[model samples]
Target: MGPVVSKFINELSKKPRIERFSKLISGLRNFNKTDQKEIIKELESVMKAMDKNELKGALTVGVFEEIKRMIEDRKLGSDNDYLLMKCIGYWKAMKNIVICNFGKSSLCKRFELMIFEEMNKKEGKNEKRLIGLYESYYLLSDDSIHENLAPIITSCLLKVASDKEESPETEKEVEMALLALSEGSRGILVKGAQHLQEITRIIFHHNDHRNLTQLAFQCAWRFMINNWNSNSNSQIVVVKYMNFLTVVKRELEELAKCVDWKREDEEKENSLAEPKATQIIVRWLDVLGYFFIMCNKWDDDFYELVRFIVELFRTARDNEQEISEMCAHALKMLAHNENSSVDAFEKCGVLDVISEELQQLKLENRLASDCLSIYLQIVRRLSNNSGDETDEEKRKELKRKMFEKLEEEGLEDVITSFHETLEYNQSYYDHSLSLNIFDYFVNV
Candidate 1:
């Protein structure tokens, strides 16, 4: 968008692609050292503006070699601009080039070594360089290069996290490191599963640092989502030995005891009662939902997890829309599994919460519609899934009780209103869940 980048893109768009771009690179280098430094500052911006074909053409003429040479000549921490520009330029070039060609290029391995060396520097003197390296790694999330570099990055992050002397610089380092890990490939997560213990520690130890704590939770969720279904061994390593969920459960328990969901003052000095507390709660809700649903096992821990979520719903004010939606999703995940029971929902007054929230929901908001769908599923499950009531009389009695509860909570009217609104605004059949639930209520 800048003038320099615009002019460069215009020049590169001319005929004879490689010759033009190569000549441009040559021209930039031909400038005197002082001018060249200024030109190099604009180089990354220009590269970023190129399309995939244009980038391929640039790489064909070995532009990365020029960047690499510049990086090699500059001191790591002294000349920060050159290193950051070249490192980021290399990353952008890697992204545009086809992945099949990535394996053949030695750039990934060479770049990994550079990052590894910078991350191991003593006393954190090269914190800026480490930040740059972490950012470059973060930018490579789309590429498979993370499969090779994730372990090394995680190791370095653990070392920095374990350092007792904390500062803004180290916290920023940890934040970026976790950001990179959060975007890591499934292979990166499964292979680096051993680091879950350290990551979990980072989550709780930095509870007051909202960004760090949130990123750490995101990394844990990424790991669980990647490995929950197919890698039981990895799950065992994280959940059983590392006690990842146990630690999270303990944190939630402590929060439940101290934090008031209906508190009028979010600006209170206590961090747990802060606005960011909602974000952390939302993330953990996602993690706990996916973990219990995918793991496909029953335990008292899940019951307790459901209890915490339900309590959140029961106490959360009507203005807390995000918490309400996530609670719906979390409860749906737990109830969708056969091993779990809906008794927790009934006892925790989630039915009352759902009924109240549904009446105020606007189906126009995608989240509200999705929440409505989840609430419908949970209601349907609790109504239909008779776990051990084999006797006909007992089954009918349970069904009657559920239906009576639904009626007492005015669910039929709320659902009918939802159906009418959707029919008027959008395709009636688009919300087949609402339509079907409406039909279910009518048939009963």
Candidate 2:
């Protein structure tokens, strides 16, 4: 032990119960800055020693837990020692500690109780506290938050998010509320039927605010996916999110304004202020992807969705990697749904775009792998989804024509080289491509 810390611990151990721990806290809080640093360092040592079971009750009294329980139970309004501040350096640190040191143990329960009780307290309604609660749930899955507390947390979130109309601080509160509910294991939302409806309304009202709308877009998607019934009348279930779809379609139409649908444009780059424009567009495209995956109909702006994705890819030039990756990924998801989807792809001339883009991207190796993945799906679906059904002979005739087209575009060696590159580099970009596209097609 260091001489200074050993001396302090010996002095600390000699005091009686009533004054011992409280006096040490007083010193830790009020002593000269140098001495306080030394004491806190010693206390940290004690914490480690306690954790390691190396210090077995040589010193007495469990002060912090006792103080926490007493203060909360007695409604002692004092912010004693800024103790909670001294602890919880950020919810990230606490989350890592809980997961690493105490995996689902009594200590975790104690920490959860302290944070939740503070959040639910009526007298202290503030942004920082709400944010702390947000981080708590965000970092941990928060299995500690039981069913009864769900309504309370939901109400708290509603109250916080409702303040966006007033001022900036309140707006931040709304942002925090949106993040907490949409993200992580939001136990509050398990009981949030009315809550989700209200948030959806808020999303519509603030549809002009891109960041809020995007986050709220995600929250809305989560609600639909969670409540979606895959078996029982999927149409009615899909119809429930009609308002969400209408809002998204309007916003997407607004974004696609002045967007060039032709690739390699020299003049028409959508060079906008605030790259946030592209980001929000990506979010909207993601929302549309989810819509198509779950809804799976040729209705409800489905044709427009296809048009938008095709334009998204066409506008994705050499510099816009994020846009290209997301466009390709969203396209791939929708394309895999059914046979009618493949027909729509070809009908939209998207297959033609793919052939040309393959020849173009043949040299642009720095581009995203999703570009390759998208076309691979098209070639695979066109062949594999066709079988020995009524149109077998006719299907082969159509496949032959498509193959002739692909071969003319020089995709045969491209596909083989792509498969060989992924194999050689051991870097498979998207596993969903299934590495089996070569088995169904003949060479050039």
Candidate 3:
């Protein structure tokens, strides 16, 4: 016999099944670390030289029987890391070998099913063991294995989501693993959105990892956005998922505040580290901005939508142009609703910022015309709200101040458009004038 064969037989003869399995796994470490194609050829050669079915039969029986015997004899300690790692190595080796040869097929499915069946049986007795099985499955990267393993991963994630006793660390690890698996097999996950939402909620609530939460949001967002077109049942699910996102947004806001406060202190001690809180706030604002814009087309709570725009402006310090443009778009939305326009003016700092930008435009480009249009809409709305002489005086004062600002900035075209729109509104009370002005400025 060759060295490898003789060494394997000698170990198998001297050691118990578990110890022999550990040694076998130790011997295969270099093989697993090499190129999978080479590993596959070597494993195939070994399988051919040794009886494949006989080895599998012996290993399966030996492992299962030993586990049972340990349980009955009360000899098995809680720590099963060695045994679990051995199982992981064996399965991972088989998985890599199979993937390097044949693509995903019935043979791989049979292997996955057998592994899951074994895990499911043990899950009833020990959750940690089942988790170990899943972690092992998660570590394997064969796309074929992913395709075969997605449903099982989804089921396991769902169980973890529902189990209150599972630690947040374990849940976060599983969530990341499930995300990686889902990236390889999207369709299987689309069919499992209900379970996915449950997992989303668990992660959103219990886990504190930002990247993990972001992945959960992305996964759940895909499901919700796609299923929005399905039946009412699916639509309801989508809404619930959106509501969960809203909760997550709230949590993120709180965490962001804490980070901001902490970073302020850190900056005092170390001046080189740039604060990333602005980036995080901007990301969430962008998501909220899109969400509000989508919902505002059908909903009447325009003030609620404008509050997010106001928050964006309040938080934005350095990126004035970007925030100003976003605020301008949001104001355009509110301008369509007469009641919302006045509330937006009172609630948002758009007027103050637009005035500042317009002043700066004397030296810079007159791109402040975009904000100028929204300010004009607010003035028109305020003018319309006025009935008495004093209110009319205040309205004209506001309009005169805006026109003077535009004139100083050399935005003659904007000033002329505003005058023409006011005159047209005076003659015909045309709401369409606002629409036309909004279109002209938005395109500009």
The candidate that achieves the highest lDDT relative to the unseen native structure: 1
Best by TM-score: 2
lDDT tens digits, residue span 1-444, model 2: 556655765787655433443455444433444555555554543333221112222222344444345444542233322323233222222111223222143433554565577766888566565555544443333345555545665566656666556564555556555545543333333554676566556655565555454444554455444444445355444444444455555666666563444434333232312133454566566545555566544554556656666766777746555566566666666665653455556656666666666666643242335556556555565565455574555545556766787668677776666664543222545555455646535332
Please provide, for model 1 over 353-391, each residue's C-alpha lDDT reduced to its tens digit, 9 standing for 90 to 100.
666767777766544454455555555654554556554
Candidate 3 residues lying further than 4 Å off, grouped into runs, are: 1-164, 174-249, 259-280, 296-302, 319-444
Give me the runs in candidate 1 sitting further than 4 Å from their true place. Answer: 1-131, 139-146, 162-176, 183-188, 192-246, 253-274, 379-398, 421-444
lDDT score for candidate 2 against the true structure? 0.50
Candidate 2 error regions (>4 Å):
1-114, 120-128, 139-155, 162-172, 185-192, 203-246, 256-274, 360-369, 384-401, 424-428, 440-444
What would you estimate as the lDDT of candidate 3?
A: 0.43
Candidate 1 lDDT for residue 388: 66
lDDT per residue for candidate 3 within 1-444, as digits (tens), equals: 355555554656455444554344334333222232232333333333332233343344234334344334444333332233234334333221223211222333433553566665833556555555554444332345545566666567455534534555655554444433333232333355565566556546544534344434443343334223335454344345345344534644564464443335335334422233433343344434334333322222334445545564555433334434545554454554443324445544555556555444422122344455556566556546467677566656655655565556555563444554454443443333344443332110
Q: What is the lDDT of candidate 1?
A: 0.53
lDDT of 1 at 168: 60
